[model samples]
Target: MKKTIGRKEKPYMLPYFQMEEDSFVITTWHDGQGFNLYTSNERYKTLERLISRLPKGTIIEND
Candidate 1:
């Protein structure tokens, strides 16, 4: 008989964000997940800058 090992899946987190500009939006997900969604802007320079400054293990609080 052979034994098999199972892999665990990552948990999903809720997303939250604030509109910073007409072309870009900043969003943070649960469990310290963060990313930016570009509505129309393709440059994405500002979004990249902001995400880089975020601290590790940082989560967004919901009201």
Candidate 2:
């Protein structure tokens, strides 16, 4: 995995890890109270499972 920086636009981007094996860009940003994760649709299930371990007000939806 290669760590890289994302675009500096709206909502403020965060550092992302690039998976060359699957060509995926995974990143997470905070919105003061919670976190917003950005990734490919294929990882939705995996992401959901991971977020399940976190507190209810952690991951922000519709971000």
lDDT against the true structure, per candidate, is: 0.53, 0.52
- How many pairs of residues in model 2 come into backbone collision? 0
lDDT string, candidate 2, 1-63, tens digits: 334466444454546665454354433445555454544545444756656667878744545
Worst 10 residues of 1 by lDDT: 1-10
Give the candidate number with the greatest TM-score.
1
Candidate 1 per-residue lDDT over residues 3-58, each given as its tens digit? 33555555556645554554655455566455546454445456565445669775
- The whole-model C-alpha lDDT of candidate 2 against the native structure comes to 0.52
